[model samples]
Target chain A: MQPVQPLQSVTSAHTDRSLQLTLFIVSLVTASVLGLIVLFIFRETLPALSGPGMLRFVTDESWHPLENQFGMLPMLWGTLASTALAIFLATPLGIGAALFCRYFAPRPIVRPFRALITLLAGISSVVFGFWGLTVLVPLIARFEPPGASLLAASLILTIMILPTVALMSEAAINSVPESYSGGAAALGLSKGATIRQVILPAAKSGIFAAVILATARALGETMAVLMVSGNVVQTPGSLFDPIRTLTANIALEMAYATQFHRSTLFVSGLVLTFVIAALAIAAHRVEHRAGSHHAA
Target chain B: MQPDSSVSCAPGLMAAPSVAGSTLLTAQVHAKLSERLFVAAVWLAAALVAASFLWIVADIAFHGFAKLSWSFLTEAPRSSGRKGGISTILVSTLLILAVTVAVAVPLGVGVAVWLSEFSRRSSRTARVINIALDVLAGIPSIVFGLFGNAFFCVFLGLGFSIVSGGLTLACMALPILIRATESGLSAVPHDWRQGAAALGLSKAAALWHVLLPAAAPAITAGLLLGIGRAVAETAALVFTSGYVDRMPESLMDSGRSLAVHIYDLSMNVSGGDQAAYASALVLIGLLIVINAVAIQLSNRFMKSRIQPA
Candidate 1:
């Protein structure tokens, strides 16, 4: 029996070694896929990088690629400005929605609202684009001096990101123990006071992180913003003026562009990747930190 | 609907159990102001989400109805966005969905099962797998598109087709399903598995029937989420499912899904705003349907599965 046990144990150890090997290979493949994408983006954009007046790509605002003048300062400005507008519009709403869902809503009503929020989050950007073009454009046209402008794009984007922000914030809020709130209430604090002084502070890191991620989502958002932002390469002075986001530019032109024009698109994509990557890493770190605090 | 009741929870007066008037008054004013601010913020969020729904309905209703008769859904592609219905695209979406689920479920479940049930407690491989899944989840869709373009489109000579799109999407959603399934199985009560094994059930059999049934809701939730993501995706699908408007008679055939069609229409048709809006509405409607159905199932299944004993 002892001899047989030793043999069986050896076989089990052998199987374990192979299983570990399999998992290692999966990790390598996943990492390589990301590496490949970076390589391709850089590779595809090489032509534009090599082209004339390459230093002016950052400073030149007049982006007539056919004229071979590839300045993206205005495009960069448009992307940043619109993204800021969206973040500005979405932050308070997202936090409030999270607070309402987490602390305020009655038990019977919470589930359905949660479900709706989840559904909203799940809807496609293409669908959002479609909606923006059809519904939002007309709505904006009613209010705006000019129809389908930067404001319109920001509004659509703000809506698109609400669910993402709300859901994450709600999760963060939910993680704050009832004990904290209860203790505050017991100490003669009203519900509002308790939530503000005790709960919101506890969930601050999380809510901030959620806001950042929603910003990334806003920045990366393609289809809906494309349809309604009027696709103008120029920068906006007033909120109602037409504008284009960096993402909208890539998605719009990637299909037809060639030579320097194509590589410029790759540069925009690479720019987008770096921007989102920075945001993702930061948000991810905050989320992890929030999780540890939650566990504690 | 339930928001009003929450709003009525009077912020200031009931703040302290002692209920001092001065603090109460100040708190009330503070609460009133903040509450209004909160209301504005939350209402804006809710309004946008609600407007998204309205946009879909209004867009499709105005434009799509103008164009969509029975023929709109049942017809083929045309040069003008005005005439073509999404019949082939819709069908392809469904077919691709079916294939994706078929491919993804088994592969995801197998990996989940192997990891959750078979892994050594301290195995470095398990940690590697977890990290790999995390990195995979964070990857942008464009990368997946690039992969499909090179590996499937050029190297493998699959060309742009539903098969390639479905496969790529399957890869995208794989980590999601596998993670969810693992969490579900882990959530299964240990005693149930033990009891099953004591009753002469094998380890595999115990997991299959006894443990999995308990974990089914969670796995289903994950699958539904994946489906929602897959259905809504555009970038990767654009590359893999070539822009052919023809219906996919076989998995090998090239076609657009509803999403790609929307992108193609919006980008191409010079004044296709109406069509784009209409297409958006249809896509949003489909997304809504998926969400509603997933929620319904998740709710029903989760309720029944909660162990009373």
Candidate 2:
């Protein structure tokens, strides 16, 4: 009986080891693929670094790649400004949704409400873009110079980030120990008072993390903005003005571009990636700080 | 101007009365004010969200409904952008969607199953994989397109083909699929595992019997969401999938998708605004139908998992 049990145990160990090795290889492959993508992007962007007017191209706002002129400042401005608008538009709606779902909504209603936000998140950017083009562009035309403007892109992007913020905020709020709420209750506080004072403050760090992630999402958005934001190479001062985001610039012109122009677009991508990474790092820092504080 | 995040509140403020069902003047006023403001804010957001949809739908219904025709869907794209149906683009889009799902779903599900049922989340390897996935998910589709173009289009010489685009899209769906699978597997009640073991089932058998079935709905929801994303993606496919208007004969054929068609049509439009609007409506309609199905599933199936509060 002892000899039989040892043989069975050895077989199981072999099976488990094989499974683990196979799975590890797959995950590693995925990681390597991502690394490869970054490398190739940098490789593509190299020529643009040495192009005739590389510095001038980025420093100036004029961005006609044709006729030996290329400037990325307008693209940078449009991307930043539009993303800011999206963050502003989404934050309140998301926070409110989180608050309602966490406290006010009934158990049955809460799940459906959360699902609706997630539904918005699942919708593809192309569909969002199409929705923006047919729906948002014409709608914006009434108030804007170009049918597709920075504001239209911002509006669409707000919907895109809403679910991320709301879900994250809800998780943060729920993770707060009930003891905090209980203490507030023992002190003779109203539900709203407790939520505002004890609950929100405790969850502030996580909420900030969520907001930062939403900001990253807004920055990373491409298709929907490409559809709604007028693909103009100009720095937008008014919300209604035609504008080009860094993302749209890459998507719209990458097909037709040649030589140094192609590399410059990749460079644009690299810069955007760096910005996104920075935002992610900031969010990680917030979560890390919160984690340590909670531990302490 | 401010959404309250403050913790300092007036103490002794109707703690018992609210629970005991008594209303004082000051407390009543505060409660009334709070309720009014909260309700207003929440409902207004809902309305705003709803309104955005309405504007899009109304515009499409107004335009596309007027011009709906068999020819508009069946005929090949024309030089005028107004003279033909989106049949070629539509078919190509469908093909790409099918290929993408076929590849992405199984691969995604397999990895997810392996991750959730096999690996410990606390392991350094798992943490690294998880972080890598998060970074991949956050990378812009445009960046994905750039990579696809450079590696697959130019380098591998899979020049502007459906397979190239579909492969790129599979990466975009990975995180969603993995996250969903992880959450779903975790959601399977722990007792089920113990019960299976008690019945003398192997670990794999237990997972297949007790866990997979339970997690199926959630995983399917995630898959559907991935489908929705794959359908709506444009950037990564732009360079990889050539703007060839013909239907793909095989996975190697280059083709334009609905989104690309719209971009091409809108940019190249010469005669009128009506054509762009009409095409936009078609694209939006298709997307709405797809997303609405996903929404229904999630709303019904993932109730406990969602965070509203």
Candidate 3:
């Protein structure tokens, strides 16, 4: 019996060690994949950086790949403007929907309501682009000559990002402790007042995180904005004018781009990655500050 | 200005309590009006959300649904994907999904198990891994495409093949799967673990027989969501998959996906609008069905689990 017990213990220990080793390998693989992707993009983008320097790539508006000019200011403005428009359009509606779900919607209706938003989130961006091409572009053409302009792109992006913002804000609102609302109730505040003053403020950090995530998503969006934003390399003057974004530029030219053209696309990818990382860090700080405030 | 002075003076007056009463009444009315406005705004917002969803679905269905047909689902595209069918791209999409699922599930689940069962939340290793995942999740799909182009297509000699695209997609799906599995594992009540231990079960046996089964529904949901992302992906497959319109004869052959096919026809193929619409309809319809089925299955599993317990 003693010998059998010793053997059993040894086998269990061995199994435990193997399980940990397997999990460690998985983590290592995931981390390496992330690191390798960054390294590859950086490595491939070096040639473009060598000739132009980083500032010239961003500041110059002449993006004729034929003439060796790769100024990206127009596209940068296009991306920033469209993403800003998306955030502006999505935030009010998203927060409003979340507040409605938290305060006004009955218990029986909330689940289906959430499921609907999740469904919206799952729809592919290409389909949104398709809708924009067929429906939105034509509608915008009523005011503008060609419908595929920055306005159409911004409108499609607004819809594409709506679900993400709505769902995240809902989750944030739900995560707020019930005790805060209870105190509001005890103070004789109306449900509307409680939601506006207490719950929304408490969920501010999560709401901010949601907006930043949505911004990152809108900026990185390619196919839908590509389809609607006219694919031109000019800075848009009005909502009616067509423009290209950094992401759309990469996808539009990658197929046939060679040499410096190819490297420039990779440089654009590198810049977009840095921008997203910056937003993520900002979000993390916001969350950390909110967490400490809660702990206090 | 005179009214403001009169109001202030009334507040100080002991003789004109009626003026103060009227001022309090107006203040109450003002509060009520603003509260009503906010309530109205919330209702309008909710309605807008619902309406926007319906509007998009209806618009797509109206334009694309009629174009769906039998050959459209089964035949290879012709005329630069402007004339015939999307069967080849459909096949390629499924192939990519298969490879992504096969690679991501084991690694993601393993990482989740390690994080949930072995490591403390406060551990430095766990924290770093979490931050790494945060970065991964935030990365745009185009970057994945570029990496796939350089690392898989060029560096690894896969050279714009289905295998290259599949591996890139697998990397993209990892963060979603790991996060889902972790949440599912965390959702399992603590008592279940203690109960297994009390029954004299080993830790390995308990996890295999008890906790894993309990988390199956959530893990399944995660898998379906990952599949949805893989199916919807375009930019990542563009460079790695080479946008060829043929049915892949082998893993190394380059192929087009439905999303890329739609892009090519719409953006490049002149006079190909109808074909593009038909493909979009098929793709969107398939995605909706997948999402509905996932939600239904997860809900049913939750119901069954909760009732028995």
Report backbone clashes per prediction.
5, 7, 0
Candidate 3 residue-wise lDDT, B273-300, digit = tens: 7888888777777777777777776777
| Cα lDDT over the full model 2 | 0.76
Which is the winner by lDDT between candidate 1 and candidate 2? 2
Clashing residue pairs found in predicted model 1 = A60-A71, A129-A224, A188-B16, A189-B15, A190-B15
- Residue range A186-281, candidate 1, lDDT tens digits: 776666667778988999888888888888778777777887888888878888888887777776666678767877877877777777767767
Taking the tens digit of each residue's C-alpha lDDT, what string does model 2 give over A10-72? 675676567667766776776676688888999998897765656866665588777667777
Worst ten in a row by lDDT for model 3 chain A:
A1-10
Residues B67-134, model 2: lDDT tens digits: 66778888887774677777888888888887778877766766777778777889887777777777
User: What is the clash count of model 1?
Assistant: 5
What DockQ values do the models have?
0.33, 0.45, 0.58
Comparing 1 with 3 on lDDT, the higher-scoring candidate is 3
Per-candidate TM-score against the hidden true structure: 0.83, 0.83, 0.93
| TM-score for predicted model 2 compared with the true structure | 0.83
Candidate with maximal TM-score? 3
The Cα error of candidate 3 at residue B128, in Å, is: 1.2
For candidate 2 chain A, which ten residues in a row score worst on lDDT? A1-10
